[model samples]
Target: MVVLAKAELEQIALPAAQPPMADVRAVDLSAAPGPDRAAAARTLVAACEEQGFFRVTGHGVPQELVRAVEAAAAGFFALPQAEKEGATGEPVGYGCKQIGDGGDLGWIEYLLLCLTSAGTVPAASFPFSTLPCAAVCTERELLEEYAAAVRRVACGLLELMAEGLGIEPADTISRLVADAESDNMLRVNHYPPAPRPEQQAGRLLTGFGEHTDPQIISVLRSNGTTGLEIAGRDGAWASVPPDADSFFINVGDALQVLTNGRFRSVKHRVVVSSERSRVSMIFLGGPPPGARLAPLPQLLGDGGGRSRYREFTWMEYKSCSHRGRLVDDRLRPFEN
Candidate 1:
């Protein structure tokens, strides 16, 4: 847990090429619009194998929609405390750190919404009838649009990953993880300004403790505020500065399970800034609630025909993740 000033951040020297904790590859989706997907696939695969994280640009998401979502988030968080509290619920709604599960509160507030309905899937099929954004209608509209846009990008990335793995993209991993009935959650995190900007040991504290996401993939967009950090291959932490031009794509525990440990699920944390509030939107993709997950047969090799992990349902995994402490690999319990 360290905070570096702008001068200090600039002073830290990194390797000329392939820096230890700072190398997150960026891929342009629009580079080859005609299905000749050589360049993007190579970069995407390499990034996933190296760190399970990358930046994506030319993703075709409208800038106006992004801005509208950001503005709506800001407005929603600015509402009265009671108003925010009205949106609080179990897995889907507003949550303040002080009232978090087991009292291990992070110094942040969030609104979680379930987005399970798609084409042909009735809107009533989801867990919640309406989003927590009833406080602001525009927020709901913008968030729904943003979620669809992000989902498209996620699916496209999954297709590239499938091609990289030399597998059937539409019938295997991508299909399973992004199925119409899959459990998809959107998290809107609001890290309020820290009360003490002068504190040395506990500067801003941590918005969220270090942990790997339990879903298949996470697509995140930040509002130009630095708070996220990812652990590198050497167990050292590197800051991920906010880049408006791209979304930070992170592989999650479910993906690692599907890849049989070839692709990693990076460990990351959010560190708050004492001087400014920060907002980030994250879209989570995972298997259907009742779907049983394990290392794909195609991914398993000739180790006496053994799999790295035992089969487990998405519901069971989600329960394990929420019940246990948020640290280290949450998938270890199911490892064979």
Candidate 2:
């Protein structure tokens, strides 16, 4: 790993504006492919290649829906410490699960599920406490609604990604996912106030440490707090701003391994913020189940084969996530 100087990190922490909220919506997927497609694809590629991150607005998820989920999450965190502990899971830095179920909280007190299986919290790989605010129907409804919207947006994005890669979108999608049950997740994470950044920079890190995502890409939605950081190609770190209405997308680790690094899985992390609370939902792109994961055939092109990582089940990779060993790390768990 390349250790960066504090100044370099600070430089990376600089932020750029998200695309206008009205322009790129969550529901824009409904729009037909117009001449805007070229400009949009070019812009998307620029961001991906240079920053590994960018925001999308008009994403179609109503703003009220986003607020409702945030509000419900806040209400849950507002509960008494004991109540919170009752629902909080796995320890911090390792991804929170339910408490006594015993892991500590990651920089978040959160819940993890999927758009496809909304409201039904199954046993996920990186364990933690179950969702504490099960009673919050508003949160569940709004969340699932947003998740569904995102699912549509993700499909559109994948198609766009396929176009960007010069192949038919369905062709790429068919090869990456398992069957019809490809993996997609929704994590509602809460990061409470924390120790000063100056202090943390010297010792322990925040909710998560720096690591690349392990999925193809992730669509993220966050509240107005800035603890997220991304690594620049120049070895700098940049702050990922909260672009209202838009979702942040970045490639994941598994994709990089499968692509033999042709597609980068940039490093990103969540940091401590003393100013206010933080919340965000990140969705990962993956295929159904045991599709022999490998480099997209498109990448192989009419060219030679380039093998980097061996094929494995998304389930197998996800399950071994908590094995406590790093040398043979393969599965791409939610948290870094």
Candidate 3:
């Protein structure tokens, strides 16, 4: 990854402007099963339809665990560039600035890890295994624990969505994410503060470019500093207020297709803060490579209504998404 100097950083800046706060819905995941749970499910469905985004409270993830993982991430990113680079691996390790081979750049550094079916990082290929911090078992433990907890929250949300949609089996959607060969992933992003010159100019740098997740869903948690924004119904950007205690859920492209357009896959991006750094942890829940993807029949009208998207395997869609730019309409090629 190429490190940008002050001049290069300034060149990438955009005019700073505050966006209106999004009127995002919040769902209480701890709601008990009967009428309460049903009501929560309805709200979740409405949120998905309205913004393809929502906040989750009573998610059951321990605050201490979240903090521990954040601290560990801070420690890892604080290492010298060379040391941090040592953990780099193909598509699943330390990355700086450049988002992908497609030439997209951001004012961000990140750690990407693939999770196993059991929700644990593979020991042999652990990205941090060679770092000095590897000896600190607590760091690794924190990652595993955090992944497991977040996965539960993600799957639970999927089930709630299925219930609200009146799908027969509540697990119909969650099952893919829980599959033995699921391609789940965890990403930790660190967006450092902008350069002083850029700050003085009141310019905002793109921490992450706008794009929709290719998986079924994404669960994200970030520190108090705000930078995240999602596209509103009018195609204008709306700022998402930071709530470290709550989890934000995003409907992914796969989910949008599965629901036959009833749900939307939102476009979101991040801008860098001049004085504060932003750190976010995201859990991307995907299905197995071989799993078939198509609009669920239940969502279609009687007599097997026409499908909006052509049938494709998860691997095929994943490949297509990877080959395109961040803002490309990935679903266009598969559209009927």
Candidate 4:
């Protein structure tokens, strides 16, 4: 864990600039199944087509569970650097500073965990087991509960997306995520506060670099400290207001391909704050490694018009994405 000092942050901080607040669409998922649910689905589809991002409320995840998991993650992140490093593992565990093996760096620290189809965290990758028995038990339980709750929310949202697209079975897209072999992951990120406002010149520290998710979808919730920004279609960045109670969704590269270019894969990043830490938990929903990814025939016109992206397996796309920088256009090679 290489923590950056104030001087190091200053050297990398970009000039401060205020971006316009994005008018992100919000949908209420608790609507009863009928006209209300239909309306909500319509809204979701519009949001996906326009920005590939939206905020969701009434997601059914208990606020208490959300808070508990956040607290546990915070406690772990607050641990001494050496103590936290004990839980480190390959691809899944505690990581700081370095974003990926490609040498991308960020002003962030994170815990990455994988969830099985059974909704259980693999004990082999458990980061809390090294702690006291009681602490480990509590943390593990909280993480499992949180993962289950969020998984439900993610699947439900996918079902609604399918509905809005007027697709058959309404699970055409969602089944990929609910599959027994689905590759799902949860990441908890902590961006520490920067130096005092007066100590540094006007600048913003990059917490996470701009990038599009390689999975099918991503659901994120963060402590109410603003820093998130998403790039618009025009290629300008806009800030997203923090809403702790609602989960923000991001359409990923897989989904963009699946929809035959109807949906977009949003690019986003986080900037560090000077007064408060930002803690975010993101659930990345992915298909199995062997799952074939291509444009849905239903989305293509009756004659099955040309597919914008070439067919590829999830593993191939994931491998391609891993070899690039954070801001690289990962889907270029797959484009037709």
**lDDT at residue 149 of model 3 (Cα atoms):** 95
- Evaluate residue 211 in candidate 4 and report its C-alpha lDDT on the 0 to 100 scale: 94
Q: Candidate 3: misplaced stretches above 4 Å?
A: 5-11, 133-136, 198-200, 302-304
TM-scores of all predicted structures: 0.85, 0.72, 0.95, 0.96
Task: Report the C-alpha lDDT of model 2 over 1-336, residue by residue, as the tens digit.
Answer: 112345434433422233222122122334457766755666665555555666775666788877877887677667665555554333321234222121322345665654342222333322324344455444556666777666666666666656666766444652453234667667767777654566345433345555666567687888878778776666556666666667777767666655445566777777655457787877666666565566656676423565555666666665564343222234434322
lDDT of each: 0.75, 0.57, 0.88, 0.88
After superposition, the stretches of candidate 2 with alpha carbons farther than 4 Å from their true spots are: 1-32, 88-106, 114-136, 169-171, 174-179, 196-205, 257-260, 302-304, 324-336
Local accuracy of candidate 4 as per-residue lDDT tens digits, 159-245: 998888888888888888889999899999999887666655777888898999999999999988899999999999999998878
Backbone clashes for every candidate come to 0, 46, 0, 0
Q: What value does the lDDT take at residue 299 in candidate 3?
A: 93
Q: Which of the two candidates, 2 or 4, achieves a greater lDDT against the reference? A: 4
Candidate 4, position 260, lDDT: 90
Tell me the tens digit of each residue's lDDT in model 3 across 1-336: 336766657655767888899888999999999999999999999999999999999999999999989988988888888888988887698999888766778889999999975578876546775555645477778888999999999999999999999997999999999999999999999988776663437678888898999999999999888999999878899999999789999999999999988899999999886477788999999999999999999997722598889999999999989987898999999999
How displaced is residue 209 in candidate 4, in Å? 0.4
Worst 10 residues of 3 by lDDT: 129-138
Model 1 ranges with Cα > 4 A deviation: 1-21, 33-36, 98-102, 117-136, 169-171, 198-204, 302-305
Runs in model 4 lying further than 4 Å from the true structure? 5-11, 196-200, 302-304
Higher-TM-score candidate among 1 and 2? Answer: 1
Worst 10 residues of 4 by lDDT: 1-10
TM-score of 4: 0.96
